[model samples]
Target: MVNRVATYPYTTSMIAENMRLQVKYSEINTQISSGLKSQNYKGISSDTQYLLSVESAVDRLEAYNTNTNIVLANVNTMYEALGQIEDMANSMLTAVTAALGGGQVPTAVTANQASNALDETQSVLNMKIGNRYVFAGTNIDTPPVDLTDPAWVPQTSPSVVNSSYYQGNSTITSVQSSESHVINYGVLASDPAFEQLFRAYNLVLNNSGSITELTEASGLIRSAIDGIANVRSNLSINAKSMEDQIYQNEQDKVYLKELTSNIKETDIPSASVQITEIQTQMEAAYSSSVRILNLNLHDYL
Candidate 1:
């Protein structure tokens, strides 16, 4: 006679094993569907702090890039305006030089040219970009040059000095290009070069009858030209430096994004394979449970 072997214990063990397999299968499926190792920071516990820091860095860089672009635009605008003013100064110098050589001042021509230059220079200094006068220093809403004001006087000291025509303060425009850098790009209407330019124009307009005065004005114009050239050169250098910083910020952002992806993203292909293997194992377990449940003492005998 064959002894009875109870199949209850075996069947119960198989069910428990299948339940465990089901849980594992579900987890792999979730990972595959979500394409993330975890839904929250707690899932990526060890790297969560580092990821936060990197993300914060990216945010800071983005802010810097935005602010830098605005500063760069203003800088370029100032550079262009300065270029026009410099050309005007050169033309004035040439005209004065010609008159000095001929020993005959074309008073009307000189006056007309000076008048036009003065008008244009005033407009440029009072230039507005989106309702803000770029040359107004910290006074964004006010125009920096107001030659129509009776109180405005051309300096007589024959030295480079701030223009009395300027309505703005002495504040310089600047921006934070990066964590370690602050870029100053302000070119105010009250700059010494601008002062000299206005002085030269007035000298030509108001004192064209005196050859001595005209000669003094010519010297001032030359000095103004040199000063403007220096300003433009410095602006060009600052623009290049800002561009480089922007590029570096973008590259750093890319790197940080890649790092975040590595920490947060799941390996979909690997998880898919795991799910397939778990499904196969569950199927085998089910098959074994069925077979073992059907076993009987008579059959064994």
Candidate 2:
């Protein structure tokens, strides 16, 4: 009986080099299959660190884009409410003109009409979208105005009777849009528009039927009504502007998503073909490695 041992024809260094290349390819393929390139700097080699950073940044940018989309949606909701408010103000203006002419006496203004307008105004004031008030300032959960109280005056705090309470704050807040700019259009409850109109609402409903009351009160009411209209016009413009911006942002997001998808999302068909080819190559390499490691000079005999 004869015993034979295999002699590896390949040098130790060559075998080590081939194993290293295969290991590197395996790592890259793993990343491709999992759709992530995040690096463990503490664990991985320095060569792969750069790829990890790039993936992390892509994830961050996408997160920022998602947040921007949310802001845009909130701004869109606010714009809708603002437009509705403008319509409400216009309707009030028409009522004011009728009241001014005495064509419609304040006495004839049904409790329904009075209450309805007040309720509608309150609805406007307490409007909520995305859990935030369209009109209420920073403290949104608390509604801006409370017209439910029969004694509740429209604008003036405590009582419409108070002269000093006529003025309220007039600061605006903004919502971010994805279009790289902001939509500045948050009118607070303390805005002059509502405060003055509230006064005029009280006077319109309360004034007794006197020629002098009609003369003086009607003038002030009409002026305030016009002011409401002006604010509504401004809001209309803002709404249109925001709509335009939303459209533009949508286009921008489409492009960005494409870019990110190219980097992150997989092409299943291409990847499947690649996997098959890699499997075939791996089989060939294994066979070749086995052949090179098993040489016998006794074969010549």
Candidate 3:
């Protein structure tokens, strides 16, 4: 009897090769459709640790950007409030100085002006940003200044002058601008300038038509105006600092995003070329597999 070699090995090898080609075709299709080499970390296991680290860094940068935006908004609001207060204080000073220079007594118009200024100043001090008072320091829930009660004295006496009008503490508010940097940007309602302004306006509005009282009030208003000017200067410094921090944070975010994209984003052109090559290979493989499956020894003879 002649020994015959088994043909099973050849058939099994062809089938296995065809299966592998099918799997490769499927993978290429997925890459083309999704525009990504790997959908999950496991797909790119070799670079998984590096990719995760880049992603984490990007997330941290994004978080810093978000915090910087919030801080900028809050700072802008505070700057506006401070600016308005400064303008109002200057106007009050102008009015008081004019009246005192003209030797005029406390007129109704002047008193009304003083009262309006006081009301506006108090309102500004009590201003809120989304239910949180900006001037309230760490005590953000409550208004920084409260003069709504009848018993709240608005006077120039030693007791009233020395009294604390701020409902919040002296704690300054701060924000993290970077991993190693923080910015303190807090102003209190009970600042000495604001107190003097309130006292001057109250005294002038409640005066009994005395020129001496008006003159004294004028002097106090001038002092308050000067004090407010100093406060504005300080605020400008803080605003500049905030602007610088925002710029730096934005630049860092841009760099981090680019770095992350380099690590994870797919090269579309390169992937498209690979898809074409794989498609051709798959077609050739399928034709070869068909020929092999249809092979017959009689046809060969």
Cα error, residue 74 of model 1, in Å, equals: 2.3
- Number of clashing pairs per prediction, in order: 0, 0, 0
As for candidate 2, its clashing pairs are: none
Q: On residues 160-180, what C-alpha lDDT tens digit does candidate 3 reach at each position?
A: 563256788889888777778
* Steric clash count of candidate 2: 0
Better of 2 and 3 by TM-score: 3
Reference-based TM-score of each model: 0.86, 0.58, 0.77
Give the winner by lDDT.
1
Each model's C-alpha lDDT? 0.84, 0.56, 0.75
Task: For candidate 2, give the lDDT of residue 23.
Answer: 72
Q: List runs of model 2 lying over 4 Å from the truth.
A: 1-10, 17-116, 146-171, 178-180, 215-226, 229-301
For model 2, what is the alpha-carbon lDDT of residue 274?
A: 70
Worst 10 residues of 1 by lDDT: 153-162
- Stretch of 10 with least lDDT, candidate 2: 157-166
Model 2: per-residue Cα lDDT over 1-301, one tens digit each: 1223322333555467667657756755775677643334443354345545555554554555565556556655655665665565566556655655655655557223445555666676677777766566566566677654455543322224322331223446665543266666666765555655555555545553444443444454455556656666665666666566656655655665665455455565676667677677667777876765565556767
Model 1 residue 299 distance off true place after TM-score fit, in angstroms? 4.5
